[model samples]
Each structure stands twice: as C-alpha cells, then as structure tokens.
Target: MKGRKFSPQKKDRRKAIRSIVEGIVLLTILIVIIRALLPSRGYFPVSEDRNLQTEQGFIAVSYFGVDRTGNKTLISTKRLEEHLKALTASGYVTISQQDIINYYTAGRPLPKKALFLIFEDGRRDTGIFAQKIMEKYNMKATILTYAQNLTLEDSKFLKAKDLKELEKSTFWEFGTNGYRLSYINVFDRHDNFLNQLNTYKFQLVSGYLDRNYNHYLMDYIRDASGIPMETYSQMQERIGWDYNSIEDIYKRELGKVPDMYILMHSNTGQFGSNDKVSAENFKWMQKLFQMNFNREGDSLNTSQASIYDLTRMQPQSYWYTNHLLMRIQDDTGEEVAFVTGDEDRNNSWDTLKGQPEFIKDTIALTSLPGESGLIKLKKNITDSNIEVSVELDGNKAGIQTIYVRADDELEEYLALSIENNVLYVYEKHKGGEKKTIFSLNLELHDGIKPQSLEENKLEAEIKELETELKYVSDVELTKRLNEQLKEKKARRAASVIEGAKEYIPEIGISEAGKRFLKVMLENDEISVIIDNKAVTERLKVSVTEGKGVYLEAAPSKEGYSQRNLTDDVYDGVFKSLVISRYSTEKKDDILYDNRLAGFEKVADTIQKGWDSLINWFIKYL
Candidate 1:
C-alpha cells in the first residue's frame, strides 16, 4: 500500500542517470555555443555545394581580332584558339550580356564558369574572325560597334550586311560602343559638344546604326576656358539630349528603344564629363527605365549603376601579348575572374598617358553606301528567294555560280552565275547539272515574328508591375521585380523585329533585307553552312557544370594573383566593376584577398567527430 523504500544502491543509480542526462544537456549547449563562435558565413551556406552559381561573379573579356598581326588589339589566332581550348577544357562557358543581366535581375542561375566575350570597333575582319573562332568553340560574343564604323559604305568596318550575317549565327549580338562619338570632335567648346551630339544622333537615325548605343556617352564637360561650364541641370540636359537622341534613333531604325545604357570609357560617373553630370546622367538613364537608387546597400540597383569600362591595363606596352585575368569581386563576396586575353595584362591603358603604342591606327573606316555598295539583292519573290547582283568595285577575283536553298526546305537550286561585276540570279528555264548550296538567308528571320498576341499580354503585365514597383516599399523586392520587368520588356522588344525569322511571305520584304541574306550566303564557307546545326548543339554541351572551382589564367606569372572579398568591402568594387575600366587601385585594393569566410571549415570537423563517436559506440555495443 505505499511506495517501496529504495535501496541505497538504487538511489545511487538514479543519481548517476540524472548526472549523465545533465552532462548530455551541457554538452549539447556547449556544441551550439561553439558553432555560434565560429566565423559566420553570412548569407553563404555551410556546404560549399549549396552556394548558388549566380553568387559567383563572372568576367567579360573584350577582343578585337584573332591573328590580326601587328594590330595592337589583336590576339594571335593560334593563341586565341589555345585560350579557348583551355577554357573549354577547364569548364568555362561563354554567355551573353543579356544572360549576365538576367542572372542579377531575375535570380537566374548561370553555368558554373560564365564568360562574356566582346569584340570592339566593329571591324569586318573582326566579325569574320569571331565567326570562325566562335563557330569552332560554340561560343557567343557581343559585337560592339561605333557609329562611324557602321555605315553601309564601309568595307574596313562591319556594315549592316555583315552585322545581319553575324547576328544570324545565334552566337553574336550587336551592341554599340558609341555612335559618331568616336568620330566627332567632343571638344570643351559648347558648339563642339552640341555638334557632336547632333551628328551622332543624326547618324543613328539616318542609316544603318540599327542597334542602340549601349556604351557610355563620352563628352568634354569643361569649356574652352578650362572651367566646368555646365550646371548640374544643364549637364543633365545635354546628357539627356544624347540619351534621347540615341533612343529616338533606335526607335526609328530598329523599331524599339534601349532601356539599358553601358557607361563607356570610364568607370566613375564623371568620366570624360563632370562627375555631377556623369552621375546624374547615369541616374537619369536609370529613371528612364523606371529604376533608381531608392534603397541603401543595394548593389544591383541604380545606386550601383555605372559605365562598363574596360582597359588594356598596360599602356605604351604590348600588354595583349601577356595572358591576363581580370578579377571582379561581387557584393556577395564571391570573386570571379575572366580570361581577358593576352592584351589585358597590367591594364596598361589605365596607366598610359598618351595613346598606347598598340593603337596605331584610330581612323574610322570609310563608309560605303549599303544600297549601292559592292552587292545588292532584290526581293523578286516575297520571303522565298531574291535576285542577286554583284557590283564589284574593280576587285572581282572570285566569281562563281550562286545557289539558293530554304531553311526548312531540303532542296537546293543553281540560283545564278556571275559575269563581269554582275550576278545573274534571275529565273533559269534551261539548266544543267548544278551544285547545291545551303543558305543562312532562309533562316534570316526564323521564329522572330512581329510581337505576338502573348507579347501584348506581357507588355500589359510589365506596365502593371512597373506601377506597383514605383511605390513598393521593399527596395529589394522592387529591384527584383524591376529586373524581371526589364527582362520581359527586352524579350518583348526582341520580338518586335521588322522581319520574321525564317522566310515568311506574309511580311513584305525590303531590298536592304534581301541584301542582308545575299551577303551572308556569299560570305559563308561550305563547311560553315554544314556545321551550323552541330555548332548549336555543341553550345548546349559547352556549358555543363562541374564540381569544385575552376580558375582560368595565362602563363605569365606577373598577371595572376588572388584576393579576398567581403560584403562591405565590395560595394565600391561592385560600382567600379560596372562602370570603370581596370585600375591598379582596384587590382591591389579591391581584388586582393577575395576568399569567402564561412562556417564550413569549423562545422565539418565537429560533425566528423560526432559521427565517429556514434559509430564507435554502435560497434562496441
């Protein structure tokens, strides 16, 4: 009828069990305390594998030409091929600027080793070289042009036809470095500046400057008196004028306007112009797209917007010969370095006083009339085939028979023959055995029809998002949403092409459009025609993910170094990354010591010990 009286031994056993339980509790608390004491990873996960691929910063390398011997900007063709071979072998994936922008804006994941390759100055040779190399490597590159170099009359520079051809490759996209800004006199005089602005804008509107000028607008902000003349608002007016001009030109020529403007030549807001104007100009440009710095510490927002400046790093010296790797430290403290190629060493252009010795010739290529140039194609039949004519300018060494084929159709035809400087691609009633040829002309506008009904819905949704984003209190969310909207708008803009993808007879054709097709077919080698599909398939495989980090660098030991990055330390770095070219200050201060510190090192050791103890106990039991 009562609780049994416990023996002294039983009482001791109860006490021991209680002691053991207390000890376990203390041990667990101690473990937690130790974990807390270890260095924090901040946003990064303890497991390295858990790190998002997007968190890692990537590199965009500018190229001029491969094997352009003696040209300062040229990387030897052999060296370039070797570099690509190494990059592919080391798991690097070539991506577009759109892909990079999308990743930050939309939280899109990128391949483990993303790279952006840009070719500057719009040289036809460079386009051709890029085509060959890009096809070989299944890589994509941004072909940045200057307005002065883009006339249909130019043979030295890439013309509209060349651009159209290059764009058809699926590996090339067109971006403008500057309009006639490169060719105009951006003097400190007000008249000069005004003239420069009007000229470039007029050039864009008048002719084949089809793409939006993505690079920064370089202007001489100071007056002839060597004083900063323009007030902040005046500077804004001038810069805004330039922006509006370019926008208008793009709208008139390409049927759409550009929301994004890359700062050209300098990183700081006041590069080539007054800092106030430069910063304000960038800010105004952002506002045009309904974006701005409404939040602090938001690197991806307009607060961090800057001119995307690239430099050779070494001035007066042939830096391109040395293999260089330019590293960027992102806001998240992850570091990424792109293999910028042989000329990027030491960022010579950053230190050079005068024009670099490598840039021997800065003259704009003479423009040739596109409509009346070397060749022309008339749309005899809508969207099916065109009549080709060649008006050779005394240089007609290679004259051969012409052939035509549709993209979706397999059958090829002996389209025409060349005599004197003329090409006869008219109807041939009587024909003999002829060669069959595949043409990119047929695929010129494939799938890229005018904005579809769905695009209209997307535009409406984007407008709604824009209104919501304008008043949204959460800055971060606003930015993400804003980026999504920008991306959507870009997609929609892309859909508003003047011509359809693949020959659509429904859309009326133009002589300029026909000529684009003719030039591409003429320029393409037989191998390129056959290998187009295979190259596209290979591009998919070229971007596969792999375990661990991959570092790509050249053999020059002087050009390579490591750096540690932190979130707070990387804000300026991020700004610098976006707008400015490479500088020694950035290399030494920003890019040095970019390693991420997290809980991984400490936690893993403890986890292993705990597991080992448990396993030992199980075995003994």
Candidate 2:
C-alpha cells in the first residue's frame, strides 16, 4: 500500500463539516425540550387539588315549614324551636328585623351565616311555642298572619290576644299574610290587593296602640296618678277607623309619634302555591326588598332578634311582598322616626279629594294633586318682617321659615324649624321690650313639575322607529352584490394572466418560468387563478428547480395537460417558462412583474366584498 498524506486545507474542511453536523443535532434536541416544557396550542392544564376554598361565601338561609299535605304552615311550636336550634348550630347568628333593615339601608356588610325564619299563616302554636324558643335563643322571626284567621275559635291561629302576647315577648313579630288566607283572590287585582293590605296594617297597628293606651290608663288608675279619666276618654275617642285610609288611621293611632310598621303576606297562595317559590322568585323578592328599603349597596342583615328591632336600630325599613315588613329600633327600644308609603307618594293622600293642610303658627300650607303639580302658600306682612318658604316634590319635601324679633329675643323666639312640610318656631317666647315689632311673611311651593304630554308621545315614537330599524333585513340584496363582485374579480384575474405572457420570454425559459411560478405560488390571488379549471386547461408546463438552477418546458400554442412538480424542481421549470414567454425585452419583464402585482389588488377587491357581506349580514339580517 502506498502511503498518502492529506493536505491541511482538506483536513480543515473535514473538521468544519463535522462541527456543522453536531450543531444541527444540538439545535434539534433543544427544540424538542422546549416543546415538552411549554404549553402547546389547543391544550389547557387543570389542577385536581380539592383542599382549596372554592365557594365565595355563604348566603343567609331563608327557611319555611310545610304541613303533611305539603301546605306551608306555621302551626308546629316544637318543630319551630327545633328549627331555630338547628339554624344556630349551623353557625348562624340570630338578629332583629331592625338590624337587617339598617344593614341594607346603610350599605353595611352582613354576616355570611345568617338566616331568615319566616312563619306563614300565623298559628297560635307559632306565637306560643315559637315565641318561647325565639326568646330563649334571642332569635328574630317574622310571622305572617291571615287577618281573618285571627278569631277566638281557631286557637291554633294567632288571635288578638295571641298577637298582643307575642308582641310583649320582643322575640316574635307579626305581619299580614292577607285579610283572609284562602278563597278570596285579593292579589289577583293589584289595586284591590293593596287596599286590603292597607286595611290589615291599620287594624293590626291600631289594635296594638289601643292595647298600649289601655294598659297605660290601667296603670295610672292603679297608681292613683294625677292623669284624669277624661284624658283616657279622649285618647280612646281618638282611635277612629277608616279601613280605606292609611293616613287617617295613622293620624288617629300614632298622633305624630313615629312607630314601626310591618306589612305581611301569605307565602302559599291558591294560584301559584308556596312551591311556586322558585329561585327566581326569591331573587326578585330580594331585589324588591332592597328597592323598598332604598338599600342600594349591600345585602340585608337577617340575623337580628326581630324585624322591628332590626328596623328600629337601623334608619331604614324592609318590606317583602307576601312576607313581612321589618322595622329596626334603637337600644332603648324607642321606635325611630320614619315616613312610609307617604315617602313613596303611595299614601292615602294621593287619592284624596282635598289637600291636607299643614299649619305652623299662623301660616298654613297644602300640597296640590297631580304629578309635578305645585302647591303654594303665601302670606303678606308689613315691612321689617321676615319671609318663610317650603317646597315639596316626589323625591323630597321640606320647609324653611323666617321671622323678625328683638335682638335679645333671637335665641328665644326666632328659631328655625322643620316638621314634614310644616315650618314653625322651635320654641315659644315673649318678645323683648324693643320698640319695633315686625310682622311675619311666609310662602310655600310643593315642587311638582308637570311633564309635557306631547314630549312623551314623541319620545315613544322615536323609540319604536329605532326598534324597527334594528331588525330590518337586506340579505337578498347583499347576496346579489357579492355575486356581482365575484364576477368582476374573475375578469380582472383573466386580464392579469393575459398580460403576464408577454414578459415570459425575456428571461431564460427556465429562469423566467421560475420567476413567474414563484410569483404565482407566493401570491394567494394568482395561485387561485392558476388552480382554476379554465386556466389549468389553457396552459401546462413541467417545472423544477435544484442546485440553484431552474428549468421549465417551452409553452406550446396547442393546449396541454397541467403537470405538477416539487418546489425545488418547480422553481427551475417556472424560470424556464418565464424566459420562453417574455423574450429579452425590458418592456416584457415590466409587464410580467406588473401582471403579478395585479393579483394582490384583485385579492384586496375580493376581500372587500367578503367584509361588506359579513358586516351587512351581522347588522340587518
């Protein structure tokens, strides 16, 4: 064997080749590792861990009881007590009605574990047994009673004596389930239902007031207090009744003294039944209560001892349809001052024939009927007198007064005052010995602004027109436009194909064909045309590109079948086709380049048609 030695250049080349091969292998491994570690497209990772706290928080349980026949009842005394105990054991706190009202009205936070124990069809069992349990546990519950059911015969149902006894306990509260429990469809007519409800409220509240008055009189007599029997007689006489009027009853019973009011309703009714209490109904009631109490920001606190206590402690009232109205109170048990239906302008005064006069000192003011209607009060006085004024609207009503008195009497006599819509002196005082005495002037306005009927009609018309336009359809017109656009695009594509042939022969056949093919392959618009049935039948060529060289067969005048080639081989064949078609003229090269450029413009035109069609379909179809 002859000994041979390799040159240094050859050895260096060999080393370089080895290094390139190693680099390729390392890069491939790195890519594989990255793909494994990172998330891949269309794949999502989920954790299976179960120890995490997934629930946001617990909502207060709203509880009810049912009888054997599936009718909701409040008759079982023992069972009610057991229910309270169960609720407490579940980490729930018992609260007063006032607390619930206050929490919602003041936008305060509520406990996570709170419950509302509402008893329906106020049975005597509920007042006796449930009251004891509630008191022992310091629990608060609202009992809905059928007013008609409160008779001496049905001891199972709450009677006047039973309700009075319950009230005395401070554990259970009362509300009207309805005047009658069954048979009468009061709620079937909204107006009739409301009227009946108002009647019930007056009867219940008035009864309570009367009993308290009687008790006070009895105590006075027993103690031999100086208060006379005439005073007691006058108080009794004041207790007049007008089932049709809440305002009259309120004036007679309360005498300007603020008190708690709880309205009631039957949880189970004939039409829908208690089982009709779906989740949706519960949500609706929740929102309705919030709105009624003007509780805009937070959940209600249902953990209070009684709805009345909850309401008295808080500065707001809570009302539930077919449930109970909860009034919160203070620690001293003094009822808080509040205006109910009157605040919402849904009081008896709304339908009265004449305005209610509110008089302060020598000045008198009255609110007129009609929405946004103004009621004014004016008084004329001599010079040096001060004037007073007041305004009332659906949202708010207030009064202001002014009076001139001696400098020394300013603090004693000329005090600013406000009471509902009446404004007067804070205290009575004799004028000082100042030589001049000035007269008083006063004026009042009810702030009611009547809306224009014409404006309202026009607004309604505009809304209706807008709704019609929202649903208008133009699908057929859109389809026609899309078809027309497609045809125009096809014609434009044909023009570009015809012009490109002139430049095909300029470059060498292989190079020119390769350039043409590359332009067509890269351009979506041109590629679509080449793939078209008509174009494929008109021109055929075998093209290939390899080792940086392009080759293509010459185009024959006679049509030939289309031939497919790999990318590398096709690049060579396309170059050859371009040279054969365009010749060596510079103009031909320009034409070929320009024709290929037109493909993009054609695609843009087609895309516009697509977008217009899609948008039109979305908007008006």
Candidate 3:
C-alpha cells in the first residue's frame, strides 16, 4: 500500500515545530554561558544597614579544660562553670569565627557584646563537662585537636568516634591545632646527633608508618662532609605531608573538614620548628594554611615570612577573675588575660586540692585583691602622694579611658588617667581610705579623636610633610631604587632566559634587544634602552606573546630610575605576562618577580568569580 502524501499545511507545521525547538535549545545555551560569565552570589548573607562603627568587637577566650580536682591539665569544673556563668551574666554573647568574619568583612552586624570560646588539645572530658555546661548556657564553642592524637584509641585525647559525634552537635566546631604535636628542638639539639634522629623518628612514625620512612628521616640527619644543612624546602614537604595526611584522615573518619587553625605553642618561641631552616619551613606552611582559610594571600601578595602578621585567632587563657578583666580599646584589639595573679596560690585546686565536693563559691575570690585586703607595705615610696604612670601593654586599637578604684571608695590621692598607651594612676596618704588595691575598667570610644579646625589643619600639614619625607627618606628611596634595579635585573634575566630557551639569534635584533642581550650575556653594565625610549628611570616590564615587552609608567610625577615596577604592572593586560621561572636564592629576585606576576594572574582569575558573586548578591539578594 502507498503511503499518503503529507499536506502542505502539515509540512509547514512540522517545520515550525523544528524551528521552535532549535530556538529553545540555542536560548538555553546562551543563558548558561551568561550565567557562567556572571559571578555567583555571595554565600554569606549581609545586612542592608550595617553599623561597623557601633558594632562591638569580639573577645576570644581559650580554655584547656574543666579539671574537677585539678587532675591533669585543667581548671576545676566548678571554676569553669563560674567563669562561664560570669561571662553570661556580663551580657556577652558567644560567637563563631564565621560570625566574626561576617561582621568584619560583609558588614553583618554583631551583638553588642561578643565573645569567642575555644578549647584546645581535644580532651574527651571536654564533651562530658564543658560541653554540657556550655550547652546549658546555650553557648557555642570551637574545639581544636591534633589529627595524630585523634587516631590513637585513648581516653586522654578525644578519639575519632567522639569527634564524629561532636561534629553532629550544633553548638561546637572543631579545628586543627596541628598534627604530630611533636616537640621540636628550638635550639641546636643537633649537637647530640642521636637526639636529632629520635625527634625526627618520633614525628615520622606519629602519622605515617613505613619501615623505610626512617630512611627518609635519615635524609635530614646531620652529615660530616659539610653538605649544606637542612633547608626550608625539606621542612615544607614534611609539614605539608603531615597536614595533608591528618586532614585526609579526618575527612574520612568525621566526614567534615575544619576551617580554623590555632597556634598550639605560639608563646613557646617555636612552633614545631628546630633551627633556621625549620623556622622558615614553618613560616611557609603557616602562611599557606592561613591564606587557604582567609583567602587574603592572593589579594595582598603576603610574604610567607610574615605569616605571624596575618589576622589570626589569638589564645587568651582565663584562669581567674582578674584574667577576665581585659582592657578593650575599641573594635579591633586583642583579648589578653593579665597574668598578674599567682595561679599557684589562687587556682581552685590551690585551696581544695583533695576535696572534690567543695563549694565553688568559697573560692570565688580567687583573683580579686580587694576581697583578701591589700598587703601592707611601706608606701614603696617616700612621697606622701605617690603618683606613677603605668602603660597599657599591647593595646593599640584606640583611645580608652581607664577607671581605677580601691574597693568601692574613690581615694583622695588615687586617680586614673590614660594618654594613648600610658595609664597614669596616683595614690596619696591624704586619702579617705588609703588602699593599694586597684581594678581597671575601660570606657571605649569610636577611636576617632575630634580635633579643632586649627589642630586638624596643622595635623593634616604635618601628615603631608611626613608623607613627603617618607617618600624621600634614605630607606624609602633606597627601597624604591632597589625595586627599580630588581625590575631591570628581572627584565634582563627574562630576556636572557627566553633568548636562551628559544635560541633567538644573537646577531640580528633591534638596537634595544642588542643592548639587553649585551648586558645579560657579556655582563656589561650598560643602561638598557627599550623601544627607542632611554630607560634612565623606572619603566614597566612584562613578557607577552612569548617576548619581553615594556608598558607605560605609572601615573606618578616621580621620575623612574632603571625601572621601578609598581603594583599597576600586574593590572589589566600586564597580568597576562608570561613568567618561566622562580628560585629560592636571594640573588633570584627576578625569578621571584616573575613567579609573583604569574601568581597574580591565577589569583585574579579565581577572585573575579568571587567578586562577581558578591556583587550579584549585593544587587539582587
């Protein structure tokens, strides 16, 4: 049987359907491309009306544990509860790292009084004692523990099972103190070769186990033939392995990764580093980790050696009431517990060493000097009115007014005043009740001191002069000059490297290339000229299209020396500049510059997406 022919109308209808389907497909593809190009919205929510100025700063407190009976390494459970109770009564709200970051970076408002609570080294009792107490008060806290300890089946440290259970809780977040928790010899313990091997072996076996791992450890052992000592690269490899291994184990066991890092022994003068090589190694590792968390390294081009300078969570140990009295300056300052009181004499266990059921309130006056009464002594001075000024230690955020009083009475000769970092307190014999007892309380301001019109103008002039002086100072100018010299060297080096790799003929080239080639190859100290422009001063340099090229100078009136490459060199098309090599040598500044340029490109590309996302959220969300 012959099939019936399709009608013209039916054929037209089918064509229309096909066309519509094609149009839909094309439209979907276009939309997807547009979405990909446009940034994703910010994951963090922000407030429309953010008042960073008025928002209270965060106070972070670090606790070891609640040691009932002061057994191993902890305060009594009673003392712990009391401290928590006092903090809660003080109208302070405990916050998370995310909360703090949100307030600082995303303009999210924080509570009027904020605090960060942390427990370190992963004691299992933390879950039993501190966790219950914190939950009772509806507080959140972060726990930091090492990966090595978690792997061990022990009651002393929090085990993998406990961590997994704790991770399920809403009030707690766990982070890494560091893996290995190994004590590094900060001094030259290498004088005894056996001690060095033992330390190395201990660290090696803690996380990774291999019979041949000892052989790898021996690679770092001392040598007599004067092979250059242990280098930072070796240390970086070890540190990297340790961190990666622990993180992997945690991810596998707990199914979660921690974002916070706390320094275990920051005050101990060494953080798992032995000598110079290890120190640098630790610096690099820490920087890498910090950059990973904060994502600031890419933007700031932070030096690895300056990892300590990065904004990180600082530990403040509060063992007593005086320890809680931190003098806050403003929105940006450290929470430091003054180590004034003798913990040996004032700790909860000091009085109740044997009694586990003693009333916590009996030892409530552990840190307040006023409760015990002032110790009587000869004025410690001959003057009737002994006026002395004490300086605030390490509080640099803003101007603060400190109020000092003895008991509840204001002494006739005793007065408190603060001038910047200086704290002035005076005591007189003509006082109503002469007492040496003192307590410090702070009144915080916006940190901006209002100035009169004349004062403002004078100050502005002084700042301007200072700025000018700074630019022209010997050190500043030398830095600028050195940068210019380095740029020249780098550009010269890149040209040499590229020419060498490509085997670009040495005979025929532009006059500029000839000059560059001569200085690089012959080691002649001839000033380089590029594109008929005499580079007597600073000039921008880059490699593009597989060839070295020059860009315009920065928008500055200051003339260039050899060529001072400013930050702008990596902006726009300049970021596309190709860099082939970098080195660990001091003389390889050129290589360093090249690597930095390359890194800038990669970081910028990654950050672009984030920026787009933030902008999208700001606009749409």
Candidate 4:
C-alpha cells in the first residue's frame, strides 16, 4: 500500500505536537516528584512566643468532611479556604489537643482568639482536599476516625497508612469517633422498628431512617418491641467491647491510641443521650483518652470545662464564614471580628435595612430577628428588556428574594423569591392589591430526574424493610415489614401525572448548592430559569420599568430561633449578579437556560478525543 504523503506544514505540526506532549509528560512527572519530597508545614506564620493570656476561652469548630465536590454535609475546599482566610484575618489561631488540655487542666493561657479546628469522618477525600488548604493557611486540624474503618479495605475511608503519613506531615492529628458509626433502637418514618444497623446499612437505607434513630452507644439495645434486649450488665459489656475494639485497632495500626475523643452523638445530659448511657460513655472515654468532645453545635470551651468533657460546633456545608463568627461570638460572649470581603463589591450594594456585609464573592445580607434585610444595586437597569443572573445561597428556613424592575423604595416591584425550596414570582403594588404571578414547587431540581428521585426513595425503603425482615424472627413484625417491602417494591414503576410537571423545568434551586437563577423581563413578560434549567416559559408581569435589581432576605415564618447568637439568623447570600439589556428580536437566542450542559458535554468529548490522539502519538511514536 502507498503511504499517505504529508505537506511540510503538516509534518512540522506533528513534530511540534510530539515535542509538546513529551515536555508536558516530563514536566508533570517532575512536578509530582518535587511535590512529594517538599516539606510543607504551613504558609500562615505562627510566632515562637505562643503564650498569650486570655480568660475568654477558645472556640472549637468541626466539619463533617471536605471534598473536591461537596455533598449535603461535607464542605468543598473552596469554602474551607475562604473560612480559613477569614479566621486568619480575624486573628484566630488554630490550637492543638495538647494546647486545649494545657488550657483546661493546667490553667495555662490560650491565645486571645483561639480556634480548635477538627475534620470528622476521616474520609480520604477530606484529607486530600483539606491538605493544601491547611498548608496554605498554616493551620492544624484533628482528624476524627471510626476505629472499625481502620480494619476495612474500603478506599472511601482513610486507611492506617494514610493516617501515619498524615501524622508525619505535621498538619494532622488523629482521634476517634468511637468504635464505629452505627444506629440502634431505630425507627423509620412509618414507625417501623429497625433494631440495629451498621454504617454501610444505614447509608443504604437512610431515606427510611429520618431523625428518630439513636446512636449505637447512645441507648440500650432494644428489641422490635422497644424493650431492652440486654440487661444492664450485658449493655455495659457490649459498650465495653466497642471501647476495647477501638483501643485494639489503634494499638494494632498506630502503636498507641490517640488522646482525642469526640462522642458518637449529641447528648444534653453531659455525654450520651441519657444519664445511664452518658455515664457509661464518659467512664469508658475517660479510661481510654485524655480529652473528650462531649457535645456539638456550641463551640466555646472555657477554663471551667472538664478535661474529659469538651464541645465543638459542627459547621454545616451551608454556613457562611460570618455564621461561624456569629456563633463563636455568641458562645464566647465576646465581641468578635468579622470578614468583609471585596470592598469594591460591598460598595456597589446599598442597604435598605439590616446589616449587609460583602463576604468572599457573595453579598451576605444578614437580617435581624422580626425584621428583613434588603439591599439594592446602585446601578439601575433602565432598559425595558433586561436580564438578571444571580446565585442564591441561603438556608432552607429563610426567604431569599431577588427583586427586578422595582421602585426605588421597593413599594411596587417584581419579586422572585426562594422560600423553603419553593420558587414564587410576585407582582407588588404598595397600597393596592398584591398579585402572585406564579408559584413553582421546587421538589426535584437539576441533576435529578423525577423517575430517579422516586426510584431512589423506593429502593431505600425496600432495602430498609428487607434488612429488617431478614433479621426479625418475630412472626407479626416480620410479616408487617415484609408487607411494607412488597408495597415499596411495587412503587418502582414510574407513574405519569397529567398535571404541570411537563411545564415545570428541572431547576436546581435547592439548599444543596449555590443555586443559579436567571430571569428575563421582555416588556411585560417574565421568563425565568434556575440553576441553568428553564423553569417558566413566559409569565405576565404588571410592573416592568425604571427600577433596578434588589436583594432581600429574611427569616421565614418558621425559621426564627430564640437563641442570641445563632446562624439561624437569615443571610440572603448572592453572587455573580449580572444585569444587562437584551433584545430578543435582533439577537439570536444565546441563553443556555435549557441545554447548556448538553452543549458543554459534546464540546468536552471532542476536545478529549483530540487530546487522546495526541497522547497516542506521544506513546507509540
């Protein structure tokens, strides 16, 4: 066969491409090796004279975990960095377990603004995502582990080897989340008794297990009838076995058990859910460790705290840095510093009411109890046809609103509100009648389909009932649970509702992520999209001219908390507000409110194939 001939230009191009690939590969390998050998303690500097006296005590804050892409509870590395930067700027220094013990037991002085940071769950991703951030901030954090996880070969959780390396890195300290995370004395939402479940089983059936389940160490082992399955002596023996197992795992894996212990669950009565369990856990923890974090949700630990009894506030993934500062100030009862990010962005927003602080890349509009916080962009959208794009990052309990084409006083305007996972569009006329243009129930959003949602829920229920029925030797309970399983399994077939689901677009506007929202006002018609999905085609609007964009946030009717210093205070967080004039008649439809993801996916596939072809040459040539 004759060889295909290439022009001089094509041959030169090929040679250049090959040279670039080889250089990139060699550079990548070199960078990896250099990074491995580098000793990166931390970038945020700590002084040698570390003893600064203060009687105000220290704030202990913990996170569930960190991940590159976060989940419902785990925080993303981007958020963690912002929080650490804010804390560092506010003069908060990270304290170690030894530092905490010295402050509580030896009556030693801690830094005026000290923080005991912790990352729970001991997830491999948590260590991977948080490592660079910790190094960048020069911060120290304790990693809490499940002792049983050390024995498992699952790569989801960190192994003993990873922990040993982390210890060597000097950025991490180890602790225990008891022997494991399991639930006992469990009851489903339907009041179905599911006696006991391991962590894996609990995750497999968590949709059936709401807030009614108890920690394995919290309550006495209960049978299906909710009676104590084991006597007092037997209960103690069972719990002691957990403690012994934890000790044994630590000894086997890391030569000795760590001194830090965070209790398995929340208990207001000193340690466990109740007095008996609390006492048992307290005694065992004291016998095994030097310090125990006995509570969550409140961060302040004073000199009066027992060395064996400490507490840390677990920061939810939804929390802003201000929320943490607000909590710490309240718990410590001290005036604290806050992070005010991007003065230019802050200057652009004018507060109508309440405190509005520009934090990181978002404008944090925090409202006081019983009142609403409102802010408006200084610039007005004068064009009759305009588009507004923003991201709403607020809690489930608050009402966060984006107002477009509103009066300067906001008496008459168009409001798009996200209240308790529902989207509402309203037309307001001050002294006259207010009208609801349309309200959309945001039950299922982007990245989730209606069928997938129902299927997942049903699968969880079936799994729960099946697991329960498998172990239940009781005839009546087993029969009842089996019937429930059958009913759940029957629901696997997706049903069609003849209503407006077709009209409703899959908009991801839930509390899980920073929900992206874009609205278009063409004359008197309003078209809306949320989280890059088309939500509404066109809705009629009464008022539609002259006014600018306004952001308002307030505690929902059910969201108010009586506590003095809590993040329950609503922060109407907004970022990436882009308001511009739009002409539908003249311009081609450029908005990807419907199929942006599809376009990106196709483009990415082509780019990856081209790169793979280049890699083939790099390998075979």
Q: Judged by lDDT relative to the true structure, which candidate is superior, 1 or 2?
A: 1
Instruction: Show where candidate 3 strays beyond 4 Å.
Output: 1-56, 104-107, 186-229, 267-318, 326-621
Give lDDT: candidate 1, residue 501: 38
Q: Over the stretch 32-143, how does candidate 4's per-residue lDDT look in tens digits? A: 5445335566434356367586577888889989864466678976688878887887788988888887877788788778888999999987887788878877888899
* Per-residue lDDT of candidate 2, residues 1-621 (tens digit): 977886999999999999999888557545643442232222111122322221211122222332211222222333344445544554445544454465545544444444445555565534444444555556666665544455436655666666655655565555443334211111110111211112333333221121112111111121123234334334233221111122332234323211222222211221112222222223333332221111111223343322222211111111111001111111122222222212222221122211222111111122211111112111111221221221211101222222222122132322222222222333223443222121111112223332233333333333323333333368875565556545543442123224332211111111111001111211111111111211211121111111111111111112111111001001001111111111112212221111123665688578667545533432343
Error of 2 at 97 (Å): 1.8
- Return the lDDT, model 3, position 576: 12
**Which rank order by lDDT, best down to worst?**
4, 3, 1, 2
| Model 2 Cα shift for residue 467 (angstroms) | 52
lDDT of 3 by residue, 1-621 (tens): 999997999999999999999888657655644553332331222233443333345556666665433432476555576667766666656767676555544666566556667787788766656665676567888787877777776667887777766756666778776665543321111121112223334433222121221122113433444343556576557656766776687787677656666543332234432455346435545543431221110111112223232223321222333324322211234332322232322322222110111121111112121111121111122211111111222112112221121222222323332222222333333234433322222211223333333333333333333333333558877676666545543432222223322211111000010111000101111122222333322211111111111111111122121111111110000111111122123222221011123665678677666555544543353
Give candidate 2 regions above 4 Å deviation: 1-78, 149-154, 182-621
How well does candidate 4 score on lDDT at residue 402?
85
Which residue window of length 10 is worst by lDDT in model 3?
509-518
Each model's TM-score? 0.36, 0.24, 0.39, 0.77
Among the numbered candidates, top TM-score falls to 4
- Candidate 3 TM-score versus the reference: 0.39
Which residues of candidate 1, in runs, are more than 4 Å off?
1-52, 65-70, 182-220, 229-234, 257-261, 269-273, 287-322, 325-621
